[model samples]
Target: MKQNSLRATVRARLSGLHDAEARVAHVVLDQGAQLVHLSVSDVARLAGTSASTVVRSCRRLGFGGYQELKIAAAREAPPEPRDELDPLTATVRAAQEALGGLPATLSRTDLSSAAEALSGADRVLMAATGLSGAIAVDAAYRLRALGLPVDLPPDPLTAHLAAELLPQRSVCLAISHSGATRTTVETARRARAAGAKVVTITSYASSPLAEESTWVLLGGGQDLVFGMEAVASRLAHLTIVDTLSMILLGLGGGRSERAVSASAEVTADHSY
Candidate 1:
């Protein structure tokens, strides 16, 4: 089998690994580019672990051995010269880069399939937790304003009940950044089991939530800096939803055009 990118694969599996391996994994994930230049012993020492523990961590990450892990780490290391922008600007730039990265990640076939899914469904349900819940509400609002039947459940339990109540041809869009949100994943899984076609929006394609969905829309991973005001990942997700909404509206032809025009007219009267 072809070798996976160690950094990506291991990071995706971090939540499932044992504590020791997880600790080592977190260190590498948080500082892999810098850790690439260090030896196994050095890494173990820095992680406050042992050499044998490091080796085991590598194996747990699916590498044949420490040497192979090191090679993969080096390959994924950040380029020699880092961007010089401040953290907030850098975060924005990263989000823009991630947006550019989406075309290759999302194919024309995927977009068409998503559009078809939304257009053909009897109703649409959106559910998310935490910050992602806010995103779900935004998407639900836009779809509803476009005259598509949409429901945004206020909580996971309500979302689960709504999923169970969905008609046979309904569609559910589950938004989660990590794709490891237990409640959201379970809700999506149940939605799928109920004959609803599920679409997942997350950062990692290999995540459990992604595996359960019929279609997956991957966004950028979290923005580490920009302090508490950071919205890079959230913005990326909104962009994804915007793309989907536009595609669905386009498929609705003149009906959608007139609906949008009417909505704009209503909003125009309130503009200051």
Candidate 2:
């Protein structure tokens, strides 16, 4: 097959993997085909586990050993042929599949809880880093357009400090594709510590950030072959943000409509 079944296989076996094995699996899963590039030791260091755990995790996924797993990764990452689908085509297909599967991955109960929390929150603090930072900023802007109180901290320290001050009725929206980002996870922890409801948007269901979240809005369908671990699907994250924004706007009544109109009009003055 052009696209290997390794990712699917690892995901299927995720819960059954022991803690160290799960950590190793996360490393493998997050890295995508890039897992073929790393030595067992490198993966172990990244996953914060031993090389033996990495070997065991691969074996648990039904591979004979780590080399077998790497071979599977290599097969999935062969160079594109001139007659075959291009990089863009592959990416589009993956995204289409991911979007198609989004409904199955997202929980209706969690969506309701997240929407209700944001709509009624006293404050909404957004925390993210790297590319996820941009998503948080966009979300903050949209939330503010509805006259909802939202804060987007500029950096990790500010996010940490701001999260600590979130009132009991506040909501902290944490976005991270891997869900293991240290600063983002820490920020969510601090927000929960202050009694705010933490909502996480992440691909990894069992990430540290999810552990810190009161509501986990898990989303995935992103597969950028080269950037599987480094950069996930921007469209997928934005879709989740849009979904939540729509919910808040839908439930906010006539006042929210006016706020959106006013916000648009104010911005239109600067445009043509």
Candidate 3:
């Protein structure tokens, strides 16, 4: 099997693993067949846990031990000749699976609370860094097109300062795929300290950013592979942004539609 196929197999069983075991599974799955080369201790270190967690994850996956798991993974059939196309195929499949599973992961109450925070806020500050920074900018454009007051500075410090100075009844939408981006997490903390409602969109619900959020929107799926930044996590974050925008627009009713239409009309002047 191709590396992605191996990851798919492990991911399918992740739901059944205990939390620590699940983290181990994710680390293994993300590493794919490469996990076969790493000893249990290495995997434990990479997964931010102990060897016992790796062993438990192996058992949870129905293996006798980490070595057995590695051997089994090594024995799987190699990818077909068309494996060159697998990356694209795998990424699309991952994004679809992730988006399909999102509703079950995030409840209507969670979405509703997020929409309420954005809709009621006098100003909306978007904080993000790296790839997530692009997502924040895109989301801010979409929200501002509907006449919502949005601030999305390209500079991290500027964004952080915006979060710090956010007034009461303001909202800060922090986008961080890892949920561990120090700048984004710190901005979330400062936003809350200034009494602004914080909405966090992240890949994991248990991340530090989620803990700081007044409302948390978990991405639909976990990223199984590295080096593919736009595959699962980016799609998941964009999906959450679009979903929240729709929900906020729905709550705003006809007035919001008119705002969006008017914004489009103004921008149409630059079109060919």
Worst 10 residues of 1 by lDDT: 1-10
C-alpha lDDT of all candidate models, in order = 0.74, 0.79, 0.76
The C-alpha RMSD in Å for every predicted model, in order, reads: 5.6, 7.7, 7.3
TM-score of 1: 0.69
Q: Per-residue lDDT of 85-150 in model 1, one digit per residue for the tens?
A: 776666665565456445534546766787788878888988689888889989887877676788
Q: How accurate is candidate 3 locally (lDDT)?
A: 0.76
Give each model a TM-score.
Answer: 0.69, 0.72, 0.71
- TM-score, candidate number 3: 0.71
Top candidate when judged by lDDT against the true structure: 2
Sort by lDDT, best first: 2, 3, 1
Instruction: Please give, for residues 56-142, the per-residue lDDT of candidate 2 as tens digits.
Output: 888887789999888878755533432377767766666654555466456889998899999999999998998888888889998
Per-residue lDDT for 144 in model 1? Answer: 71
Say which prediction, candidate 1 or candidate 3, comes out ahead on lDDT: 3
